[model samples]
Target: MTLSPLVFAALIFALVVSISYAVLVRWLPDPGKERLAQLTPGRGSDHSTLWSRLQKRLLAWLLWLSPWTAAMSGGDEETPSALRVRFGHAAWRSPVALQIYFTCKTLLTLVLPLIAWALVEISPWHPQGLQRFLPLLVGAAVGYYLPDWILSILVSRRQRALLHAFPDALDLLRVCVQAGLGLDAAIERVGREIRQARPELSDEFALTGMALRAGSSRAQALRQLSVRIGLKDINALVSMLIQADRFGTSVSESLQVHSDALRTQRRLRAEEAAAKLPVKLLIPLIFCVFPSLLTVLLGPVVVTLARQLIKPVG
Candidate 1:
């Protein structure tokens, strides 16, 4: 029942490849994430999705595997408010998201190093001590930070979607306000109106309206919205709304001004990105494309010149 070195190496390669593919899939932002969040009710564990169920099972297994891992798995400690707020910005406010995230991190952090160590033990290199542990350490580092990287990516994408939706929302709010609905009513109406088109932004507005109805002050609720979103535009909009309300200024006019400003900023961002495109492309243009083109066009010429300059003794 012993495996040969070749078999062991093959197993290691297969394990690494499979794990990498799984991580790639796991890291991708789910398109149906918001929809799932909306439909899946109840607390902590979201039994509605396959991924969530998998996370729950994995967590249970981790807690059973090594009791000490509880701290690493986030099972023993209370979820941090900062992490919760960060997830909210990523449109993953459910308790299940926190569970899934920490579970994945713990699983990968523990699994990867073990796999790396097994490979190193069988590896032919045979580094004495410190060098042998290098790969394992590298694997551990990547595993620990992978979830954080994925979360940031999710936050960026959700922010982009919300940013695009903001101007339309401002217009709707302006219309609602000018039509004499109070600012609170306007938000609720806009939330309902945009639910079909911009569901994520709509959800935030709906929550803000609910908070206001639940006796939270206008400033407090608006600030909460800005916090959850963690977007500068929303933060500015919240501050503007609060100031307009506090000073008894016309809300409609403020909304109109802010809406125009958002549009202008969006255009400027596009132009700035376009301006940077050539500079960004230069690296690949020089390193990747030029080398290949030079090889194709000048490789034969160089070979010919070398042959001519150093003729073989005949």
Candidate 2:
């Protein structure tokens, strides 16, 4: 149960950081708290229920460099950055998400090299010349991009889920629209009906419904939905919906057509994946399966030839 000096030192460092955070939160004025309170959305700020929020406020304030860094970079400060949009697509629509991401990226890039260096120092293995800094540099690079990698994974998983669940949503929406429901009502009803079956798409539909209810125009809400989902098929569906809504077209018929198109897209995606199967298996076939097969097939022939040649020589 004994901790190594390295582990002990890490633990002490963490403890000191935590204590510093606690003291800083206790005394220093918090702008993060003020910002959160402004956007509190009518939640009562009772101290008992706000302990977790209180804890995060100071941390967000302490991680203020991210926004400043973004500001220093050249771009429209008003419009959301591409990184922010990616985070939104990943279903992390929180105001503090980008801030937290930047903070983690900065910390990891700075801390991992030091950690690697410490380990190198404590360990018996000594890396000479450029080899000494290689691990540290690699660690720093990995740490810096680690958050991006995670966000990409989350976005990919969420998008895959959305794609698989989308055709179901479309079918339901078409059914609802044909069943004497208005488009908005159809969407809301579809959202409710599909909630149990496909919650990812269900949530998107539900949010779109909410946005419509909250005074956003149909086109705007649908556009936002398409952007957030970031699937070609979904974007197409959004365009179709917007056009249908604008031109006073038959939504039921449009839904039917779009459903067919989306299904075709899904099938094509499946077929494309199937087509690539051999390509994906190529490496394993060559390195693993083919070698074993050659060994089994050629071993006896090679041994027989060797025995004949050796017998003749004797």
Q: Pick the candidate with the highest TM-score.
A: 1
Superposed by TM-score, candidate 1 places the C-alpha of residue 129 at a distance from the truth, in angstroms, of 2.6
Q: Which candidate tops lDDT?
A: 1
The window of 10 residues in a row where model 1 has the poorest summed lDDT is: 42-51
Clashes of each: 0, 0
Q: What lDDT tens digits, residue by residue, belong to model 2 across residues 181-277? A: 8888888888888776787888888898999999999999999899888888888888998999999998888888888877888899999999999
Model 2 ranges off by over 4 Å: 1-80, 122-125, 293-314
Per-candidate RMSD, Å: 6.0, 10.6
lDDT (10s digit) by residue, model 1, range 142-180: 999999999999999999999988998999999999999
Q: Which window of 10 residues has the lowest lDDT sum in candidate 2?
A: 67-76
lDDT of 1: 0.84
